[model samples]
Target chain A: MSEPSAPVTLAVDCMGGDHGLSTTLPACARFLQRHPDVKLLLVGQPEAVSAGWSRLKEAAAIPAERVRIVPASEVVSMEDPVEIALRKKKDSSMRVAIAQVKEGQAQAAVSAGNTGALMAIARYVLKTVEGIDRPAIATQMPNAKGAATTVLDLGANVDCTPEHLLQFAIMGSALVSVLKDNPRPSVGLLNIGEEAIKGSETIKKAAELLGAAGERGDINFYGNVEGNDIFKGTTDIVVCDGFVGNVALKASEGLASMIASFLKEEFSRGVFSKVAAVLSYPVLSALKKRLDHRRYNGAALLGLRGLVFKSHGSADALAFGYALESAYDAARHQLLARVEQRIQACVMPSPGAVA
Target chain B: MSEPSAPVTLAVDCMGGDHGLSTTLPACARFLQRHPDVKLLLVGQPEAVSAGWSRLKEAAAIPAERVRIVPASEVVSMEDPVEIALRKKKDSSMRVAIAQVKEGQAQAAVSAGNTGALMAIARYVLKTVEGIDRPAIATQMPNAKGAATTVLDLGANVDCTPEHLLQFAIMGSALVSVLKDNPRPSVGLLNIGEEAIKGSETIKKAAELLGAAGERGDINFYGNVEGNDIFKGTTDIVVCDGFVGNVALKASEGLASMIASFLKEEFSRGVFSKVAAVLSYPVLSALKKRLDHRRYNGAALLGLRGLVFKSHGSADALAFGYALESAYDAARHQLLARVEQRIQACVMPSPGAVA
Candidate 1:
């Protein structure tokens, strides 16, 4: 494959996330500054898009021609059900942005919208890759090894077959190869224990399929790993069903926040403690920087025919920009193509019986 | 129920845990000092038990009659399979300790043994409480609200039916009520989202059962709660299958350890930082004390006919003492009786369909 000389085009869902265009537009402006050879098609209601554009123009040096507004009439609120996102709000900004990717006008799509809606719209508009039954949400997390471990099925499909898990292993391996630049990255099947006989019928059967795929050189399956392995950086990629993945991610987020609050509380307790906090300010900041979630904001919705990244709904401009960068990088590296190739080449066990 | 005039008795598995009698004997010595009216039946190989008892006599004021050595011929190693623990090692220390409770020789049993072996032996010997199909491992986690929330089944049964989740909720609620002395502790069904329509079919069905139970005043079910809610203390009890619970527990542990290491590393970077760490020692110590896992060492293997508390295999003397205290507290509050009553009163939905 030859590198494109022209700028990469990306579709931004302007009316997504908690702050809608307010967060997306400024993020696009900041992203444009870092990625000069890039173009953004901001999709949202016309009036809001125009207003958001004016703010971006005032805030940064984003070129007028490099950014364009694709107006839509409807917006998908975070509370909207999947049915409304799928069939009712056909012209939603989230849907229109995904449509641009489906029509090949944009290489990838980025949204900080409601995750359920974004997944539903992306699946409906772009469809899953051939041979894959369901798509998954793959997010990056900071580990103790000072590298982000990629984990999938963050909350796309609820119940997965062993075949689905095997597919996730393949897709996750491809993702780390592009993101971390490590070909044949180790893939771990997240379970309660590391033993061969541990976990459920589905997990046991998934292990067999993953083991076979590993033997075939499709992925470096590292056998069973526990939840702590995610933060311990025991594997480059961890795969599980959406239910378990989502719980782990949200729980870790909660603990991190609680720890930060505890540190602040400890530092501000008394006069002597305040002085000690001032003396330890730099060290505390270093600790904070090490575990910052914003640096790993984007989650790739894998197995789709096109590239789509889900940003946290409450992400600020900087975090949204990180999501944009992640999506752009995925597109530049032909993440979708790699996923297709790996899935096609991989051997899958019987689905219904294993699960 | 009349208060016991005689001293409370506990069966101690001396040959369990990583440190064997080295950990359990000293812990029992420390426990007997604090709880003067308690007795311990130390079960293990004859020579090891006698040697450990001699050391305990030299260490503290544990009376000879208050601590007796009960010999068992076999030992269950950590790597032993469940079948071996169940059928082969019938006279193992783990089994003998659990048997003491079954034979009314002890009020409760405490072991820091192989989790799989402990659970199998406890189930086979004690059997399940009436109306309960499976046993669950319920452990306490310190929350941001300065209270320990009870979460279960940490890793006993994988691939649980909706009915099993309902049982976990009932059991966890009973646990909190006895431990915290709250008559109607609020219970949260752990899921991906708080909305009624979110989570897997099993979770949804469990919610329905819990909601119905709440309506009947069987349990104060608070509906669906996400992972963050566990640390937020959104409810007194959080219920999930073993797979999700184990992952969440282990992931939290990993993150906590990583954050602590990060803090220490930052404070010890250079000479100036080392001085700063000295000044902030008090604050750091407070943070460490608050998040210490040793304070919450015991996990009650609920649903057994008799009370059995499992300590972490790697616990030190102090941590093991905490597990002993927890077991004593559970026995004193009649935790098993409460569980039996709660399960008998609750209604479980059909098993096959939802999960």
Candidate 2:
């Protein structure tokens, strides 16, 4: 795919996440200053955007020419179910933000809303891209290599067939190639053990399909990796069913956060600790930044006809800005077209169920 | 469940683990010193034990009266398959160690062998306790509340039915009750989300069976809990299928170890950093100790007729000693009989396979 010279536009769900308008408006302001060629369609209730813009106008001097307010009557709460968000809330800011991509008004969409509801609305509005049976969530986890590992099927398709996993590998490879600028990003099958015969039947069959695909040069498949491989940066991309992927990702996040909190507690104890905290401030800050999940905030919803990224619901303005930058980068690099072309290039045979 | 005055005896697989006699012998010598009421049956090649005994004899004065040499002609390699270790290596130290427990020669067994081989051999020799369909691996992970959370079915039954999950809850509760001395330890179903409607069909059905068991006083089911809850100390026991449980636990360990190493790297960069490191040495060591997996080395293989605990294959003498203590505690507290009693009281209505 050829890189386009035209400016990229992104639809921002201003009424999403926990802080909603407060965090999103400031994030939009900061994002606009850094990305001169990027334009934003701020989707939210008219009054909320009007009032919120005034609050952020003094602190952030956002260019007026590149910004436009796209009014939506309803907001998708984080607690809303898929059915309610898809059918009931027709004018939700989250759904309308995605609609901008479907209608070609914007090159991509970014939202920090309910993940289940976001997937449901995005799938309904922008159907699966050709050759994909299901869409998957591909997110980055910071690794020891000072980069990130792209892992897919995070809480999207819980019960994935072997073909679905293969589809994920194809979609994930495309996503990583675009994001990392690697022509042949490696893909790994996430399993219990490195051995081929360790996991369940679904994983075994998935391994065979992946191996065959690798031989045909469909994707650069690195045979098998265990959970530690994700953080060890053993491969650029790790693929698994949504159930295990989601749990493993969350558990890692939990442990990392716990360790960070524990370090904070240890530094705040007594006089010696206070001296240690001051003397070790530089090292501690570096360690925190290296381990922070906030810096890696965006998760792409791949296999859809259009591009949409989900930011963490609890992200602050700085973290939300990272999500916007990720979306802008994806759109500028033609991630959607690259993904479609990559899937089209691969032709894997569908395996009949083995008794 | 009565507290008997009989001396607790443990069969040690001296030839197991990466360090073999070097770690196990010192660990056993230290264990015998601390636990004056415990007896050890060290199983290994006859000559190896005889020669190794002299090496440890200088560094440690292990009481001759309290230790017995049990001869095993073969050693189970860490890479041995279940079939090879179970059938081919019939006289393996791992198998003979468990056999001592079966023959009532030792009250319990502790081995740092190939996990799959250990599970298979132990299951074959001891069999599952009455009323249990499968034996599970229950291990503790350190949490925020300065206690460990016990997680079960780790890499044992990859594909578990709803009934099997209920059985795990019952077995886990009994194990925790015996270990923690809490009559009703809270049990949580490890799922993608805490919502009741969130997981796969199998998990949803398992939730129902666990709820029923909770109502009948068979377990202390705390509804559905997500992955983060395990480390948050939200529940005493977290239960999931072996595939998910194994991956989650390993992922946590990988992240924790990565953080520790990163802290070390940051502290060794320059002279100023070295000064900071000296100033923060106590705080750093405290953080390291809090996150260390070595303190929680033993993993109990539950639901077996006799007691068995698996130590980490890479454990050093200090870590292996913790495992021996865990086994000694489990056997002394009569964990096996309590687990059997709990399963018998469960009486969950096993439904036919749901289409």
Candidate 3:
């Protein structure tokens, strides 16, 4: 991990998510304590953020000068559509937070809001980075190797062409190289089977493009990987269409929660089981902490001209804090510049390097 | 569950899978002991089936008359391509076993062979049932309710049209209604989101067709469901294109295995934890047994003229026994006729009821 620079500023949407100010305010307070040199542009209703900030300033030991409240008249509700958030609610906290990055007031923006609205606003304001057609949400899933596997197009574009898949691979490689400090991370194209003739026509064509790209040394392309490979850590980045990736992500969440419920039921079935649960609590808790998905809460909205990270809509204080920390890391590590350079080098090669 | 009829015969592919006779023979022996009324037509090289049958005969207490060895000149190896297994190896065990169903000698067929080869042979021999354009593989996945949720198109048709998905719903409905004893089981169209306008164009169109089918009372259709819905037991059946279904299934398998490994690591890290592991062993093992994937081994190849069940290639004796019992149950419950009736009633409605 690179050392945090002295002047990395983040614009956070405080009036977003289910808990809104309740979760965002406390997470911001704790985040500031950990990163003393970081500056924050809190975009929300001025009164709410102001009152909460004054209350937390003394307790958190964060100087009043290091924090700023950017006024936003409207709060984007969780159910707000993309059109409403972008065209109608122009001054929404979510949009204003992103505007802070677009206007060069902050290095990055963070939000725990409606995903569609967040993506819409970010794309509208910051625009796409050169050589990218559509932006994708890239996030890390906990893998068997005890490390995270990056997966892209989590829920951004439902219908992706082979070209879009290739773009996702380029952007994902850049994101991983910056975030994980791995320059040549391997990319796996998610498919039903590992063979070339295994998936849909679109996927087969995508395989050809990815294979060619792998030959050119643009990406460390790992050929077709199945669904399980995402959790198996078979590759550093698994690229898929938004529809499939979204299904896989939510399915994992649903299964994890169900297993948790099952574990709870098994441990509390009766007296003997309850005693056993108490004795094994520490070991189990450690395992739970090791595999805590909340620690990987921030999903980068990659392929955009400016940096924006999305937090899960139902994140708690600890989870939101992790989101803030990830945004900080991305900004400190210069994720935006690296994404642009990678896209330029790989997608728009110089005349001499061109085929 | 329906009781097995007096004369239900199943054609077994004795020379498929990794262990060939080693796993298939032992599983068959145990299966016969439990299913007294069922007769087996063991399809393989006559000499091998004869030798294995004679060795397992006295110990398994099976009447020699109940088991018959049918000669197949060649065996369909795991690595064989569809073209090879179909045209070249016409008398292959997998093909010959399926031929038994075609010739009306057996009510059903079971094989643990190369999936592509088996599907090709089954489709070539059995043909698609009246209205079905293509065949689909439907299997049960363990859910939190201590029951299984049947999902269709697991790895059969990677690129399914809207009509193909609708057909899958009909076949899946019939499969569940017959096997699970639910006359009107709800069928869920698997999508990225729960909303009506959530997924790809094919999914959206499939939803409209399914909604119409639900209105006609041909099949009980649940609206759009996410990946988690499968394990949540949100519906009796979940339908998707094979690519998505395959990815979801394999991803779940990977995640489950990873969690198992994680549990072992945590419980054996130290001496105290080791002792704690012993104390929690019974509870954990009970949980494992309750959610064993092996128990859900058999995948029925639906939309065919005859019934054919595919066991997991790596299934052990107990799991293979379950596959046999499932195949027996399908035959006893008349799954093939029920599927035809459902398709005829739904797809080819009467002239008076035409839209």
Candidate 4:
């Protein structure tokens, strides 16, 4: 294994996110201020980036030389289709930021812009690794065990074959190893039931592939896991196609919102309940920290040739800063290269030789 | 509509559930003692039924004539496939109970045995309603708004066409009208987003059909709804294919379990939380009641010719009672007849016409 080096540089799509440069610039500034070794390349409309830089300079003692702005006239709307990468929005901030990674001008790229556009631009410019058929967005979710579980293909490929699922499992396993620092991370096939005969033909085939892969010691396969098993941390990596993964991710978010709203309503019902809530404030804050997405902001677009990270479009400065840190981690860990090697090792016919 | 007469008679599979006759018979005996107007036909092994009856008599004061034990020598195991309904388990309690519904001896049937067996038996005997391709299971979930939303195809068919989705929506709409007392239930197609073109081709087609159905007043159709919208009561009836619906249902269950476990762990940390918990016990109890599966049992297998309902395999007496009540509602409301009439009124020359 290679020794960890100095902090990596990240190219930020400064004109992205709900608040655009207002959120992205301050987040970059905060991240840079905290990590002295790291540097930033801000890609956006020149005027907006300059205005954001000036505002940050007034508020904080930011080292001016550590940051540089790359002018990009176009800004992809979050609503734009993936086609925006091909034609009209070629020079968009999102595209240019991704290009910085592809061109090796930056170690990694972070974008809080349109997810589809970012993915398309990343794939179009950086391309996929030799063995990966489709790149997947892998996100970390906080489990009840007080640890994070990796859920992949959050929204990459809509339709997936068994082979695609196998690739995702392999990539996710490598990712969990790097992020969670587990030498042999357990991989689980997400399904409706834990039984072998359950789930669709696609899932069944994926299970068989996982079984074969596990036997080869390429990845640690924990067999089938139901939706409920995700929070239990039954496995370090939960693999599924993009459609189910997307729905599951969104459903979890919706549920968290529902529970939060319910809790607030219950606590505000009467004077007694309000008083109880006051006493429970510390515990509630602890619980909120456990569920907070800011701590797990960076979701790597795994299986791609270059390291690319996606932050939530609605992410604030704190979340965006974490996203930058995630990109740095991926770059330092050589995540892309490690994933490629893992995929190559698994795909070969003679697994014994690789072992 | 006809001033619901006497409570409907339900044939209970005495040799069902994890504990078989031990749990089923006692539950039925207690239920009968509570609802004197209702009758039950208990089907199972004659010896087991007799033993269960003797035990029931000792525990509760129940009239013998109100409950009759029908002799069925066989029982369906939880692991058995749907084929058990066809060849092997001909005289099983699960089959006989369903047969009672078909023979008009029982208004509905309740089985806590294998889900596949119940669905198969119901389809084989009760048949599908005219113009209905396949039956769907519709389960009610507690929304954040304090009202219940009905989600269909919880686990019926894995693959569904746009037409099938439309049919499920229509049946689900009719169900909400009868059960929720909504004169014209608002229906929504469950999708990744609320936009008209947000989902796959199948979803887009289903949306068009729903719009047309809404236009003709065959059903009150709201547009697309995302996963988050399910708990928001964005629409009274949320419809999707069995595959997506099943995933969504299980995801919600997982989310609830996750939150409950998290809260439990947080509250158990110290004495202060224990005091706060006791003070807020009433509010928590109310919340639990709202989210309780017992209050939300009886997922109707809609579009079938008869009133067939599926209860949770692990359901207790309270949940079984709710299933029985739902069956009664479906039977008294003539749910099947209403669905048949609606389909006949809305069937078009081209499936695209409704779309």
lDDT of each: 0.87, 0.88, 0.87, 0.79
Residue pairs clashing in model 2 are none
Q: In terms of TM-score, how similar is model 4 to the real structure?
A: 0.94
Which pairs clash (backbone N, Cα, C closer than 3 Å) in model 1?
Answer: none
Identify the runs in model 1 with alpha carbons over 4 angstroms from their true place: A1-6, A194-197, A350-355, B1-6, B194-197, B348-355
Q: At residue A257, give the lDDT of candidate 2.
A: 74
Per-prediction DockQ, in order? 0.60, 0.58, 0.58, 0.46
- Per-residue C-alpha lDDT of model 4 across residues B133-192, encoded as one tens digit per residue: 777889998888888889987767765788888888888877887766677889988777
Rounded to one decimal, what is candidate 4's iRMSD?
Answer: 3.0
DockQ of 3: 0.58
What is the C-alpha lDDT profile of model 2 across B1-355, one tens digit per residue?
Answer: 5666779889999999888988998899888889789899999998988788767756767667888999999999888888889889999999999999999999899999878889899999999776677788889988878788999877878889888888889889999999898999999999986121288999999999999888888888898888888888889999999899988988888788777778888889999999999999988998888888888898999888999999999999999999998999898988888887777777756442121
TM-score of chain A of each: 0.95, 0.95, 0.96, 0.94
Residue B291, model 1: lDDT of: 79
Please give me the DockQ of candidate 2 compared with the native complex. Answer: 0.58
**Over 4 Å off in model 4, which ranges?**
A1-3, A194-197, A348-355, B1-3, B194-198, B348-355
Candidate 3: misplaced stretches above 4 Å?
A1-4, A194-197, A348-355, B1-4, B194-197, B347-355
Candidate 3, residues A1-355, lDDT tens digits: the string is 7575568899999999989999999999999898888899999999988998888888988888999999999988888767787789988999999999999999999999988888888988999876787899999999999899999999888878888899899999999998889999999999975222278889988988898899988999999899989999999999999988988988787777777778888889898888888988987787677657798899999988899999998999999999998899889999899889888888433222233
